[model samples]
Every structure is written in C-alpha cells, then in structure tokens.
Target chain A: MRAVDARVRALESILVEKGYVDPAALDEIIETYQHRVGPRNGAHVVARAWTDPAYAERLAADATAAVAELGYGGRGGEHLAAVFNSAREHHLVVCTLCSCYPWPVLGLPPVWYKSPAYRSRAVLEPRAVLAEFGTVLDDDVAVRVHDSTSELRYLVVPQRPAGTDDWPADALAAIVSRDSMIGTRLVSV
Target chain B: MFDEPWQASAFALAVALQDRGVLDRRDFAVALGGELESGHDYWDAWLAALEQLLAEHGLTNPGSLDERTAAWRRAAAATPHGSPVTLDADPQRLRHP
Candidate 1:
C-alpha cells in the first residue's frame, strides 16, 4: 500500500512538473480531500436500504443505530442519518466548513466534494452544482440543502430509478455511484 | 496513501489548486515534504499544515480550529447511500424520523 502511494505521489509530482496542475491548485486539492471525504461505511447502509424498506426507515430516522443493526458501523459513521430525495423535493448535501461524510458505507468522497468550488458554492448555489453533475431539478421540485456538521452526519437515500424495478438488490447496487449517494447525480438507467 | 480513486482525485485537487494560485507553492512544497517524511497521507499532512498556517497567520481566529474541523466533518457526513441518491430520511426506526 505504501509503495503504491509513493508511486502515485511521484506520478502526481511528474504531472505538476509537466504543467498539468499549478502549485496553488495542488494545495487546494489537498485541503479539499483530507478535510472533505470521510469513510465508506455509508455504501453498505445504502445498499441495505434499497433492498429492505424497513431498514431504510430505520436508517433515515437514526443512522447510527441503523448502521449498527447491519453490523457496519465505525469511523465517521459514529453518528449517521439518512435523507431521502424524491421527485417533488430534490436534496443536495455539502459541508460548507469542511467535508464530513458517512465513510463507512460511501467509501471516500469525490474530489469535487472537497474543492472550494464545492464547499463554498454548495451552500450558496446547490442547483448549479447539481447541474454540473447533470442533475436537472424541475421548477416545481424544491431543492433543499443539508449541511453536514460534526454532531450530526447526513446521507441522501435516493429513490430507486424507474427501469431498475426489475433489478434485485445486488444488481441494483452496481449502478449506484458515490456521486448518486452524495445526491449530486441520480443513478443512470 | 489512498487506495481509492477518490483519494487520488483528492490529491489531484491539491495539485490543481496550486496550479490555480490559491496557495503558495513554496509553502505547500515544504509542508508536503514534511508530511511525506512523517508517514502522513499527502492530504492529511497538507490539511494539518493549512490549519496551522491559518492559525499562525491569523487568517482564522485562535482556538477555533475545532470549529473549522467540525465544519469539515459535517461535509463528509452529508453524503448519501443507496441508488439514485435521493435525500429523504433514514430507513431505520431507531431514531426519530
């Protein structure tokens, strides 16, 4: 693992030397990640929710307990909660101060989630950010922004896509990307 | 050293930020070198240094590191799980819905 990390770092340095990323931009990116993405524990929880509605309700109400029930709770998932997104009310989440996430299930957060563009703009302009991810909210749909804080963490439980009705829970999991779990994009059918 | 793509992408963001002039190259390089030596992941070390710099330079008020850290924590907590990524409530009955 360490060797791979070093190689990757070396490669990144090479890219920077080659003028791929400016010096300052690199700092911002670093700031975004260490401070943004949390754990991947959220993924298992999400998968469970999709397969079991009863569990989904439990997760939505009390994330920590719900996760513990599934025996997949730890790290950033110490305190967890689920937020549901639907056609009427679209929800987007961001950590305006930093990147706090349900890592036990979701793995790591995407780079954009940690960027100043994402952190600062997510609260100020959620619709725009979602649009960048190709999520177009209807005018009638109200966009709600949830800011993740230290005391309470949030997860978006997106509604299952239309054509995916026939897919079993395991098959459905394949199409669920981290971005979709973050509420930035919906599962592509 | 992140084994995941998101981890690598996070490093990419730092590089991109340096390229964009949001951070000073010399200071960042110094911090990165120190972090690599201490076995800290690239991003972890950079954030620690940034936090320190912010405090040392009075960019943020003293004794507010906790607040800043908490804010970052919140962002990470807000990610969604499951398919289609909708933001509603949890699926469990353990907590108040």
Candidate 2:
C-alpha cells in the first residue's frame, strides 16, 4: 500500500470511530469502484463505437444513453458526452474547477488529474500536456478541450489505429488506455 | 485511480456523508475550496474537508483530532515501509478516547 493510503486509512478509522462515518456504507462504495467498475467499461464503449458505425452515431448523439445501452451507467457519470477524434480534430477532457471525472467509466480520477498544475494547464496548454503523455498531434488537427463538471463529463472516442480495421472489438479495446479515453494520449497498436 | 483501499474509503466516506445529509455538499465544497486555494494536495484537501465537517458537526474537536493525527503519524513512522501501520494494540480504547 502507498504511504498516503495508510494515512488516509488512519484518518478514516478515526472518523468511523467518532460516528462521523458509516463503515459499512463506506466499504460498499469503495468495493464497488475498486472491484466492480473501471476503465474496461469505457473501453467496451470505445470498442463498440469503433466496430459499429450506427452505434458510434448514437453515442455521439447521446453519450449517456448510448453508454447505458452497453449496461454501464451509475453515479459520478449521470450526464455523459462523447467526442470523436478524427484526422482533422482531436478532443481532450479536463475539469478546471475540481476533479469532476466520469468515475463509472474511468474508475477513480488519477493523481495527476487532481493536481493544480494539470487542472490549470489542461485548459491553458493542452498540447504541452498531450506531448508529455507522448501524443504528438499534427498541426493540421484542431484540438478541442471539454471542461467536466459534477453534472456533465466527457469521454474521448479515439480514432481507430491503422491496420486494425478487421480487428475484433475486444482486440481494439485491449489497446485503449485510460488516458486515451481521457484524450491525454492515443490508442496505438 | 486510488492506490489502495483506504484512499477509496476516504473518498467514499465523504460522499456517503453528503448523501446521508450529515453535511451539505455545497458546504463541503466550500471547505474544500479553502484547502485548494491554500495549495494543498487533492487528497489533503479532502482530508481537511472531512476534518472540518467532523468539527462542524461536533463529532470531534480540534485538540483530539490533532492528537490523534500526531499519534497516527508517529505510529506510521515507526513501522517498516510497506507494512501496515497498526495503531494501539487495543483499538477500542482509542475509539472511545
């Protein structure tokens, strides 16, 4: 376990002992995210979109409903939106106010997403942030930044890589990194 | 993503409290805002919000909180790295104290 995790646990134990927290309810929520939900849910959506043009259209039209069609919808992602990436355009997601992430799809927000530098820089210098993640987009591709909130969040539908047209949905999903879905990185072969 | 069980626990506990109406979400956000503005880390801000809410509800006082946090830190310091930092052998005493 991480050092920070230990400190957090110590604090939680104290809070529970003081009757400020309910241990069972806390455990239920933790176990749900830790074991049941994660990025795989997002990957499945991406893979389906990559394989089915109709589904992709539906996803673009209504992300929350489309995602729920695949049986993945819950708290932290009630209102969802999907932005498709193409040769001419790229999409990136950020939460400038706070760490408002699509938890059902992305699991928990990463440490960097919650950092002050990332929150501010993602809006001011998205290209630089993407570069640090090794995603070098061409000058021709226009980058669109989407700001997430407690009510609305975004998911990036990355362009399908070359040589994967015949690949199955599962194969495509295997290459979809969590960062790719977040638009900070690309899905590579 | 959370690195361990407690990190998620800490996060979930805050959410649960708000859902239970123990504290208002907006109020917690206001407290968290102060931490963020003060340049604290995200989880640190979360911890601060939790502490602030507990105090506001009269669940725990600042003195006891400080003492408990210091004790926890000392216990963690003495433990080997990567090992579980258990507090006092009798947790019940600490619980009631």
Candidate 3:
C-alpha cells in the first residue's frame, strides 16, 4: 500500500507540476467525499422521512427525485430507490455484479461490500450475513435483498425503532447507522 | 470502491487525467482491457494503464515512474500499519530515512 501511495503521489505531483491537474481541486474533491458528503446525507433523508409522512410517501414514490430534493445526487446514485423495512420485512442492498453503491447517500462502499464473498452471500444467505453483522431478525420477518446495478441503486429505510416517536428529526438522524440504511443492521432508540 | 488512501489517489489521478484530456478514455479502456487480460491485480492493471497512457501522452517516462515506485516501497516498508505514510521529497532521504 505504501508503495502504491508513493507511486500515486509521485504521479500526482508530476501531473500537478505539468499543469495537467490542479492539486487544490484534487484536495477539494477528496475532502468532499471524506468529510462533507457521506452517510450523513442518508441520515438526514431518513430522519426527514420519519418525521414527515408526506415526504416519506414521496420518497417511496420517487426516491431519485426525493433524495435530489434534499440536494444529494451524483455518480453511483443517478437512479435512487428507497425500500422501507417494516416489522414483517427486512431490506438489504448488495451489488452482485460489482460495488454499485449510492455514493451520494451512503458514501463509498465498504471493503466487505466489494468482496466476492459478500456480493455472493448477501443474496444467497442474507440471514447468515446479517447474523454476522449481529443483526438476527425474527423468523417470521422476511428478508428482502435488493441488488444494486450500475443503472439504479437501493437505499433501505429501516423502520423507526420503538420509543422514539417524540424524538426530533435531528435526534433520530443521530442513531441511524450506515449499516441500518444498508439493511445489515437495524436502528435502535 | 477503494480500500486504502493510495487506491483512492490512483483512481482520482486517472479520472483527473482523463478529465483534463491528458489521457483519452477510449485508449485507456483498451489499455485497461489489455492489462486485465495480463492477469495482474485490479489496481495493478489500473496503474499499468495509467503508466502506459502517460507514456503515450509524453507526460512521464517509465524510469521516473520506477524511481517513484521504489521510493514509495521504502516509505511503505518503514511506516507501520495504520500509520499515515509520507514520502520525502529528497530521493536520498526517501531511500535511507
């Protein structure tokens, strides 16, 4: 990794020096993904949905437009779809073909999400995979795995946990984990 | 899609190059395909494609790329896992420090 880092940095420096690339722009882009843009965007969306039933209805009807309404859209998230997780059903998202994740909402896909084992098993034995993430569901709860393709991506809106009905959207957003949005885990109050 | 900082950098550099018209996407795709057929790791193929594109574009030479690769190898070897890796500007310090 160090070797690769050194080589990449060298290439970057050369490109920047030659006017082929802008170092500041590069830094800004990296900073955007590293800090500014990420799962927090999805949290806000989820929080809004929990607080506003009308917005939730709109999100369910057109995830792309609703998410864009919140100002989140870009590569890997051009076509966004939201799937609600209820007590009787659990939702999970995976990219069997490749790591076709929704970057605008979920940030970059994790290493496991890109691994062959995860891509295959996420659809094959979702229960077992969820169990590994410490999310064992009720036997009666149906596990619905959504596969993300290059054209469309899925975001799982976990059912609001019990005892948080009065909580504000900001407070609700605080407890929504990336895994919960991915459906590997559930949100808790 | 990337696991490490270097991977992200490599990816970004490629995109930057293509965006700047320094590297042609169609040519890059062909090179990438060839690299993939060569059976190297994914990023390795990416690096190979980038290097080849740079050569075709007269941006940098293989010798310089090799020198930088060696310098980075030393830096990586010296740095501990989970620690940030920094490359020294001076080649001598990069080799010995």
Candidate 4:
C-alpha cells in the first residue's frame, strides 16, 4: 500500500487542480495551525471576558462574533458558543461523533478528545471525567456537557479566580489554560 | 498525536474542506464511520475517507488519486537526494510547472 502521506498529498494536488481547494490557501492554513494559532488565542478571549464585563456580555451573547470582533480569523471560528462556568453551572466540551474543536481559539483537539472513551464518558459522566483531570467541583455546581460537533464548537469560560480583580488582562491570560477553556482543567491563581 | 507535518496537513485539509461547505457533517460521517470504531491509523482512515468523499462529489476518482500518488513516489525515487521531489514531466500533463 502507498504511504498515507503520498496519498493525501496527491489528493490535495488533485483538489487544488480542480479548484475545489487552493494550494496557497491550504498552505496558509497549514502554516497557521503549524506555528501561528493555538490555545493562546483562547486564553486572550477568556482574559478579556474576565477583565471587561462588556466584552464578557458580548462573548456570552455571541461567541463566534465576539471572537471575530477580537480580530481572530481562521478555521473553526465560524460557529462558537461561550458556555460560562459560573457558581451554579460548569461546562465541559466533547465531540461525541468526532473530534470537532474550536481551532481558532483552542487549537487542535487533544488526543484523548478523539478517543472513544473520553468522548462517550464526557457526556455520560462529566463529573467523573473532570475529577480524572484533577478538577473536582462542588456538588452544588451543575455539569453541562457540550457536544462540540463540527458545526458548533464550544468554549468554556471558567469563572474568574477570586482576588484577581486588579490583575491586568495579559496577566490573567497567563493563568487561563487550554484545558481550562475546554473545561477539562480548572484555572486557579 | 497529530504532531507530524503531514499529519497536521491531512487533518487541516479535512477541516478546510468542511469549512468551505464543500464537505458536510453527513459526508464526513458516512466516509469516516467505519474507522471511528477502529483503534489503528486514524489519519490513514481519514485520508481514505476523504478520497472517497471527493470521488463521490465528482471532484476526483480513486484511480486518479492512486495514480498521482504512485507518480509522486516515482518522482521522489528518481530525484536527487538534496533537492525537492516534483511531478514535473508526467505523461498525464503536457507541461510541468
């Protein structure tokens, strides 16, 4: 059998020739995912929400639009919804069918996300899954699992840690993690 | 671990196709359904499924995809060690770019 790389490259070339895909655009996207975009973009959005109530409101109202407003343009930013992890509710995201993710914000989906166990268990037992990630929430806080499918991806806005009201947005962003935005890990300090 | 360059490229290609609305969720699902249950070579399965989808959409056929891949392999084998491998003068296309 031919190497998968060769096959993929061939398919890409064919697609490019047919005009279904543009080689330049595809290369740009590959370059972006390779070295440009990742979890940091998501952290910036989280930090902005934490620092500015107005921005947070905008994010809450329409996450995709809010993210674009922040000037993040790339793949997988088209459909997004910010699920705020407040005192009353906590959000966890998983792509049950496949590893759909917010590429513009959170970058690529982690390996475990594409696995069968994590995908099934995340929705079935979110609390247990969170505990496995070293995040054990109180019983009062509700667990809302978001099935982050291809069309509509989700971003978990973890609640602002206490006593950081005076911190700058950049400083706050430093503590916002990729898993925290995915709701697998909680942000502290 | 989609850490390799080709791995990222393959994954990105699918996402890019879907983003352009050329490939939908149902198309992705039908193509990738079988591999979703397996434990091996997820990316290979993904590429195969993409090829199938492209064929179904009349973009390109499986035979052409295979032939082009073989051509690339031959080109790489024939090229020098220090330079790039390009499908320059194949009989299928009159001019090489």
Worst 10 residues of 3 chain A by lDDT: A1-10
Q: Candidates' DockQ values?
A: 0.08, 0.39, 0.31, 0.48
Where does candidate 3 stray beyond 4 Å?
A: A13-20, B1-5, B14-97
lDDT per residue, candidate 2, B1-97, as tens digits? 6755555666897888876778776577667766777888777788787778778888767777655656666666667888767666323445555
Which 10 residues in a row give candidate 4 chain B its minimum summed lDDT? B88-97
> By summed lDDT, which 10 consecutive residues of candidate 1 chain A come out lowest?
A1-10
Task: Indicate the docking level reached by candidate 4.
Answer: acceptable
Tens digit of per-residue lDDT, candidate 4, span A77-170: 7789999998999999998876778988987777887778897899888998999999999999989999876678999999899989999999
Report the C-alpha lDDT of model 1 over B13-84, residue by residue, as the tens digit: 444544455455456545554554565654666545544443454544434433333332333335353432
Return model 1's CA RMSD, one decimal.
19.0
Clashing pairs in 4: none
The per-residue C-alpha lDDT of model 2 at residue A114 equals 80
TM-score comparison, 2 vs 4, better candidate: 4
- The positional error of residue A92 in candidate 3, measured at the CA in angstroms, is 0.8
Model 3 Cα lDDT, one tens digit per residue, B1-97: 5657777677677767766767775576567656756665667777888888899878898787777667666666777888866665344663454
Each prediction's TM-score against the native?
0.56, 0.80, 0.73, 0.88
- Judge candidate 3 at residue B40 and give its lDDT: 58
Measured as a fraction from 0 to 1, the native contacts recovered by model 2 come to 0.37
The deviation in Å at residue A183 for candidate 2 is 0.5
Evaluated against the true structure, the overall lDDT of model 4 is 0.81
Off by over 4 Å in 1: A1-41, B1-97
